[model samples]
Target chain A: MHADSTTTRKAAALAAFAGLDREPGVAKPDPILVVDNVVRRFGGLTAVDVAHLEIQRGSITALIGPNGAGKTTFFNQLTGFDSADEGSWAFNGKQLKGVPAHRVARTGMVRTFQLTKALSKLTVMENMRLGAQNQRGENFFRALVPGSWRQQEDEITERAEELLERFKLNTKRDDFAGSLSGGQRKLLEMARALMVGPELVMLDEPMAGVNPALTQSLLAHVKDLREEGMTVLFVEHDMDMVRDISDWVVVMAQGAVIAEGPPDTIMSDQRVVDAYLGAHHDAPMSAEEFEEQLQEAEAELEAEIEEKA
Target chain B: MDWNAILITTVKASIGLETVVYALAAIGVNIQFGYAGLLNFGQAAFLGVAAYGMAVTVATFHLPFWLGIAIGLAATVVLAFLLGIPTLRLRADYLAIVTIAAAEIVRLVFRSVKFSSVFGGSDGRQNFSGDFFAMNPYSPGTYGIGPISFNERVTWILTVGWVLIAICCGLVYLLMKSPWGRVLKAIREDEDAVRSLGKNVFSYKMQALVLGGLVGCLGGFLFALGQASVQPDLFSTEFTFYAYTIVILGGAARVFSPVVGAAIFWVLLVFVGNTLSEAVSAGMLPSLFTVNNIGAVRFMLVGLGLMLLLIFRPQGIFGDKREIALDAR
Candidate 1:
């Protein structure tokens, strides 16, 4: 009933990392986040089990891995989307165990999803409203009587309009979110997330489906996120983009970290190459390749049947 | 009937039990569906629950009318939270499915054999309107000239109900224009984006759900007070269905959409039904059609009309399509 393979992958990764505990309770000074013995699991599938992971303060960190390397799973666990089977993490020294997704978000550890979840029916302006903030009017009792809540409402509208203008979505404010192109939706999603002014912005994949033209804009936005004193954590497949922006990189394969360092070091690590790059783990096999392999196996079976006959 | 008589009658009928009730429910739904993007198909349950809440408190517990009102509103909020907790995080359709089922279940519980003693069984509870009528400003007489006349008690209820509608609509307008309203609209548009901004998507949803449910519950209070009665069958799925029709008919996200929709919808229903019945009875039309069949036939015609409207203009009278989305997905 649930696609929780993510949970299992994280658990296995955490266990494996625990076994390689050459490092102690030690961490780099001024770490923004520390994941200690974080284990997440699905039924019979260990997805991410990170014994120790530290996010450097105010630096852009990229978590990279093959398709099933538990990168997204780990992201889920770290951000409170999924609870760790066994682990504890902290944001700005506040323990983030058993914290629900929203509570964690309230604490400034915000995250964007891989697939965009733009509310398609609302106008771009309405979408901005949704991203605005808590107001007295949000309460039904307070929804009435404008005098008590109008000033606050005005502030939210002003803020939303400012952000929409900055993101170049001002003209489209009256347009339905569904009418926006894919890249525009991406921009809207990013801009909407910034409405809260988060300290850490965890982007699942800021450029997975982005076109070349919008790629630079997204990259610049990510840089801006860094410049604004917000930590950026993204899962990206574009090695070139990764090297260009990521201050540090952590690579994972088969639900565990294979390497962690700068993008250049991670790209060259033989373990990472064998698990992802050289083996083409990042790209799922095409339908044609799968069919060809199936045909070859069927042919071999037929030959064996003939011999038996 | 004369043309003026027909027009007057149509307005009177349209503004009666159906529109008054539906307008209230749509206001509640505006909070949920319009602002929060919660596709709650069981809005009638809020009405049903509140009706029963009032009934149970006043009739069964023998409590005062205002106390009954408090209990009803409280019960509605609790019901919204209960329904929201399990389903809010699920896909939109899941909530729809669960809410429809829940609404039916609430209706059944209100009418069930075990609880029939308190609920008055299928016969429903009457004599509950006495307290409301005690405050009626009108003496026993028809107030309006021509076909626009209303009995004293009925006139009183309409006045109160319309005032409530005005207040609710104004509230929606002001809130939606405010910052909090913007956040709700944003959540509707992009929850993940809101989530990344450190807003609690689920909490916002819960808030919207409860608030809307409470507002929807008000309709039930009005209905019970209006009729001086509470019945299980009155809270049928059609009640919620008609509310959605009103919301869509007037405009989904617009503040006054429910009011316009309720008025237009009731007017259409009354006009169509009366015209058909009169035509049939007076032998001005085919003999095959009967007054009884008018109920079913009118629905089909209305449905067809609605479908055409949706195809051509999903946004009703005053709505900008961008203001509200018809896409449940």
Candidate 2:
């Protein structure tokens, strides 16, 4: 499927997302989501305090942070899963300040949870069908008249089957979602999200609980989303996976964006290191020890990622 | 010592008036608790309010039978709204608590002496069923085969009751298979998940509450019309509990489960009671168990059977085990 023309288009999209990665809180030429002054507080603790951020259209961005950096909280605020104490944002230039979570999804900004929220009691195919947009059968009155929605339901089933096949979950279509393995649930969640044909898909820790064997495939699927000309934003902890697939990296620490750059630059940036290690800015390590610690941190991160994978 | 009489009575009880009444109530519970995962412990309130609405409308206002039916239905819808608006958004247990309390309040209000003039107080209202029986087409004659029979009045009630049951079952079957039904099941599994998928979860829940409550009101109508009287004490919390037991016995989330369950429940209850009483009369047991104690003993057996069913198969007879793993939070 990697034809010559498609490779050029992928490269073109990659180039467009380049350079802007180096600037913190930078403006994008073609932004799909723009957030300003978004803050969420729980009691006295402020969980997220994003001042300004823009996600470029048709790019794969990674939101990476330590355990308590509030990446997921920020994701929740952006997607309307939770309300912000003070904020305003837009998706494709449509103001989404007070929009509900479902409406946010309707605007082509679909999201999946860190822990997969597959309807465990529902069959795999049913879970996929639930993801489809504007289903006629979902209407209360229209649902009773089969003639009004049967054809639409059939079409939805067909689309769901196609996605199941793509996700390699076709054989398990009749099985309850709860019966699937952890990795399969994650795959099913991603596949289900695509049933909306969304322009922007935000996944929270897609590979968190996946097996290593499936993590590679999950990574490939994330890359394929961008290849299909869709914008992908994911919150992840694994540096290797982020470096492997992310076009740009946005670092968060203490609930604020500390740096934005390409994977290589972000990995080497001093602030990113301090954010991860909690090291003081004035206490620079010796060259040899610094390199060793960096390698040690990467290895430790890899082991942790593998355990979850 | 007629074993023949006992067996016949048990068979008749399986398809008797009580079965029809409980079946109607359980089917409504199926929609709320089974399909939507709603904890509607006030199902009796729906039946009570509807029954009282019909009784008060006709006996107090001296209105026509048709008008009373309309008022009964309207009252059920209003009761659903009144109960749902304050509790639907809360956790599942809150709904359970609220509904049970609401049912008790309704029963107490109806039985209170303050409304004795209008509601007939503890005696409840009678004579309102005259119009219903008048509309009955059956002539004055006994119906059915030897050993099992019904008079014209009962025959008419059975005909109407069975027809209503069929219609309600058909409606549930159609709705559960539709996309709207899919959403209800999804809400049962995870309301947040459905909401995140762009569905108005709260609205769907309210609709299910109203629909189920409305369907349950049919049982109220059948209870009053078949007995030819409406009593406040008849619609107690135990009434709702019995309906729940019927729903669970039939295997929840299945359309025909409630019907089958109600039949089996009444049959078993009557069968056990008859057999025990006969055994006691025949001197087959000790003097500690008298015939009058048979009623309580029969319920104990049913309770035991239910516990066994839950332990061995928590999903009931026809239900998928996964369906009962409710995300009630």
Root-mean-square deviation of Cα positions for candidate 1 versus the true structure, in angstroms = 8.3
> What lDDT does each candidate get?
0.79, 0.89
Model 1 local distance difference test score: 0.79
lDDT of candidate 2 over B136-232, digit per residue (tens): 8989998888878889999999999999999999999989999999999989988877866778888999999999998899999999888988999
**TM-score for candidate 1:** 0.84
Query: Which regions of candidate 1 deviate over 4 angstroms?
Result: A1-29, A119-178, A277-309, B1-5, B59-62, B322-329
lDDT of 2 at A213: 99
The candidate maximizing TM-score is 2
Off by over 4 Å in 2: A1-6, A21-23, A281-309, B321-329
lDDT of 2 by residue, A266-304 (tens): 888888889887776667789998899899999999999
